[model samples]
Target chain A: MPMTIDSSEVLKRIEDAPLLSSSASRLLQITADPEHSLGEVADIVKTDAALTARVLRVVNSAAFGLISTISSIDRAISYLGERLVVGIAIDICASQLFDKPLTGYEAQRGDLWRHDLRVAIASREIARLAPQDMAVDLAFTGGILHDIGKSILSEFLTGTAQSVLETIEKGEAQDYLEAERAMLGIDHAMVGYELARKWQLPEPLQQVIRFHHKPSEADEEHRSLVYAVHLGDIIAMMGGGGTGSDTLQYHMDSAYTDYLDISVEQLTMTLLHVEEEFSKMEASLLDGKDGGT
Target chain B: MSNLILGVGDFGASNSPGDIVKTFALGSCVAVILLDPGTRSVGMVHVALPDSSINRDKAKERPGYFADTGIPMLLKQMSSMGCNVRKLTVKLAGGAQIMDPNNTFNIGKRNILAVKKLLWQHGMGPVAEDIGANYSRTVSVSTNTGEVVLSSPGRPPWKI
Candidate 1:
């Protein structure tokens, strides 16, 4: 049996929910203009104490391979650069957005968090291989939040939605999207795109949420970034880093190669690279959060 | 039944006996399987991306994840297991496109192409294979007979 989410109710809840702002506004402002001074970005970051602490902790983490310790957000921003600092802040912000439990997905409170982090790491690595025209940070952000819609649906799948969850756990036959489409009439990607648009996320990220599961549908301008996230998600899923509820729907779009100017040879190399990076990033991101939220 | 088992996130074991040398649910990644009929040995790798040169730091942490780095490592491991490079027969699988058509995510295609290129460079070519499909696959290789099989949803098991 397929799953379903009441689109109207989901949309209503999203609308009613308070717009929780993290450091995303400041980070987006910084990313919009590269020439924007670090002082300006730092000033915005200083307003949020929690964001400031997360930023400093990440900058000091071994993932960046910084030789010296970063004592403050400003120092870390200087060391990591405007683009990456902004990217990390945005990621930290979205982490809160996805902190809720996903019922249909069988994801624990933090399962989505780990999944998003893996996709971000993989997307950044894949972006390095694509043409320089692509924005690597944009790719990373898109990858991290590609499944935001799942969180929205999870909340509404209250009573009868339990069956959908059961079907997923059994690994019966249907992919999550199909189950969702059958049960809820709308898939997570669509729901995610709606939420993204409502939240005023950047176009590239919204495009990713809509097309990460279907990259061939993306426009020429955003195709490569969409493709990177698609591949990154696949790499994470294949490596056993997935949330384990939706393993049946591994779909691949062939046109992605032609769009990205990459051959089959390049794809193989890229997946290898994604796997390597996921391992490193996974260790770094989960360093002390063992107790599980 | 002494079937060779390739552990998760790992590659290559030759001259071992087992029911299968298997890699599971390869989506955008590629699995390169090498079989030696003479030695009845088999090896397989579940690689996530095509290259490691993009980020050397990540590559160093997980060598088995990239095609450029992992394929060579697989070959070296096979050789160390008493399998002759010349007698080794190769087959490839995985690299499914799991996203939409318009999104331009072709990492699976890239991994498939990368594996083929690396094989060509190393004077090794795939004798038979199934790659670049739109669905995920679980690949299994029998060490006893060097038979490679692919299983997908609603599809019959087929030999490569």
Candidate 2:
């Protein structure tokens, strides 16, 4: 008999996928702390030569435009901040997954990375403007890993794009997430949550990965952070940084207004900041670098 | 022959007959295309926002990012290239309402309105447009034939 595929099958595949490097994993854990120090971040980079070089290059890149070259890992981590340091570490560790072609979504290679970068920038920007205090770096980190589920889900979704779209169009499904659940017996969020568990990502980051599309579903303690990433995801898509067929298919939970109180003018400003920061980071990190595995 | 690709907050113009000007993946952003039949001159601006009052510095740095600034700059560039305003054919593409259902995030609608208002202020309007959708778009204009084409994901490129 042909095997019946389900979320278990997707979970099994996640176990087979390459694990995050020990250094990258350590960076994620260290940076998740609101009081994480420059030394803690520097210690992780000091051990990895490739990551150290990339961090130095990015700090000196045209994006920062420092007059003097800083060769020390401590200065580099301090200058770039733990958020971006973590981003670079993740980019190096998962370049293959980040830069892969989302064949099911009909998206090009590097599309996912670009989208994630935009989301990271936008998330950080929104978090800075929120009325309540929150960890902006955590939001940025969440944005980077929010759509990781897509990398694995794409293979299972091959040749299903038209049906998914038609299902959305006909209102048989609420959005792409629902469509994925209806067809595949599992959505990207659940698949991503399972991966987060496997990777041992922080609870807040895991919540962001699962509830980004619907922030209300996240735990109350992390709701605001999740909301920031939710709006950040929307802003990234609005700014034309979406990944393929399901680009704008997800519903924007207006409940975010309850968590993040900001006017339309402020929202527009966030878009500008996202574009500016996205261009700089893309040029520094991924522009000339070989993004392939 | 050259294809001038305009990124967000950017615009370009070409008078060469073999040139094509285009912008990619316009989600909420709008692209204004100007073509002059007399000179075969074409210009394209990828407008990202409605007004420049929000950030004058960004507007100064990249006038092609806002309808209030970008439209005027494109018109000025086309005229400077010796293309006649009266002879210009205005066509607009993009300005899609991607995820906003409650109109809370209505940048696409606002952008469409702003671009139309700006063009009206210039005493012209889009002769043809493909605007206000839930999908993203990539728009291209041919300086050779004054042809405006739009392509979306999973869809064929079509002329407007």
Query: Which candidate leads the pack in DockQ?
Result: 2
Cα RMSD for candidates in order: 7.1, 2.7
Model 2 agreement with the true structure over A82-177: per-residue lDDT tens digits = 888899888887888898899888899999999998999999888998898999999999999999999998888877776777778889988999
Q: Which stretches of candidate 2 lie over 4 Å from their true place?
A: A1-5, A287-293, B98-104
Per-prediction TM-score: 0.63, 0.95
Model 2 Cα lDDT, one tens digit per residue, B85-111? 877899888887755545668999899
- Model 2, residue A132: what's the lDDT? 88
**Over the stretch A1-293, how does candidate 1's per-residue lDDT look in tens digits?**
53344668777766754453656765664554536677987887789876676667766676667778777878877865555555556555555556776655555677676677677767766777775566776677677778777777765554434355456547763456766776667777888888877777767777899989778888777888898888778767754456435542556666656645654445445545555566555654454223211
lDDT values for all models: 0.68, 0.86
Interface DockQ per candidate = 0.16, 0.59
Question: Candidate 1: lDDT over CA atoms?
Answer: 0.68
User: Docking category for candidate 1?
Assistant: incorrect
